[model samples]
Target: MTDLHFECTGARPEPFGASPTLLFGLRIEESDHQPVHAIALRCQIRIEPVRRQYEPEEVGMLGDLFGEPSRWSSTLKPMQFAHSSITVPGFTGTTDIDLPVPCTYDTEVASASYFRALSRGEIPLLFLFSGTVFTGRNGFRAEPIPWHKESSYLMPVDVWQQMIEEYFPNSGWLRLRKDCLESLRRYRSQRALSSWEQVFQELLATAGAKGGD
Candidate 1:
């Protein structure tokens, strides 16, 4: 068995409230063991309040708008985990992890369209994966538990973009923005142009025939 180190970068933050957050980019390293397939390192979040009290106007407005379920306050809410995981293969060890959570406004919409309407940028949720060392057969295993801290605010996507640009200016951060747009465009194009599954099946058939030679 080969020893491999694994790291995950770009784990997004979960919405606790309007507080600023520090999102971490992961770096994993290991020796003497093969990396496990689909191992994820969960992130740790910590929140400290700068102000002591919630804004009266904000609270009032929430009560007026939500009618009763508005428990909006100054503290960050608990972090919510997504049903997703990161996959890696072969490993000696792994460390520092960041994984983005997919956003589906369906639940939010069903509960409160007002809350969903207030959304901007990407949602501040994270994907938590089981962290482990020891990949294939004949390898040693280390099971890791995920730890999460909650706050009372959501970090806007715009804030995250600005932070990225500031911290990693020379890293071609705009490329990531462009990539997100490009991916969305590609997905929309495929949906509009034809059946994606049919297209994929055709390509598979062509490849299989060629390989038969």
Candidate 2:
């Protein structure tokens, strides 16, 4: 059995991708001098919300996901961030690979909302690794990568924000029902509203007026 060590060095925003993505740097080092042919690795990344403190505003933003902060004991659980896989080419003692973690801006996704709730500080992350490892210099032998092999990294919040900004600058993402969007579009046409923002403002104004009445 080959015992490989896993280390999460850090992460940064990917320069170019079809969508928002983060490139995590991982180092795989072998204890013995035995050469590693290749590694077919699958990584499951999770956000450890319970591992970090939340600000007042952040608490409010996360209320929809976790409910009241008082109930966080049961609510603040590890959320799935991304599931990614990569093939590490053959290497000797140590090898580094960039794990691409794609992201979405859809607020309906708890992961996206969880990320948006964070403004500053580091995000505690847990990376669970599993897969098959091929070893030997002359010939390759297959072995299962240890299931317990894992690593943790505190990723800076700015890295996420920067990636989002690159793809969704000065914008926020939301999902609306087809009928609801049609209704808003009809309202916009009727009132000659220029944008969806105007329609939302009008609705808020009307709701406030009714509340005061």
Q: Model 1, range 77-151, lDDT digits (tens) per residue?
A: 433333334544443455555434333323332212222233244334332334443345555566553332222
Which run of 10 residues does model 2 get worst, by summed lDDT?
30-39
Error of 2 at 156 (Å): 0.8
Q: Please, what are the lDDT tens digits per residue for candidate 2 over residues 1-213?
A: 788999999999888899889999999998786898889999999999999988888898999899987899999889899999999998889998999998899988989989898989999999999999999767879999888999999999999999999888988867999998888888999999998888888999999999999
For residue 17, model 2's alpha carbon misses the true position, in angstroms, by 0.6
TM-score of 1: 0.33
TM-score of each: 0.33, 0.95
Candidates' C-alpha lDDT: 0.42, 0.91
Q: Residue 190 error for model 2, in Å? A: 1.2
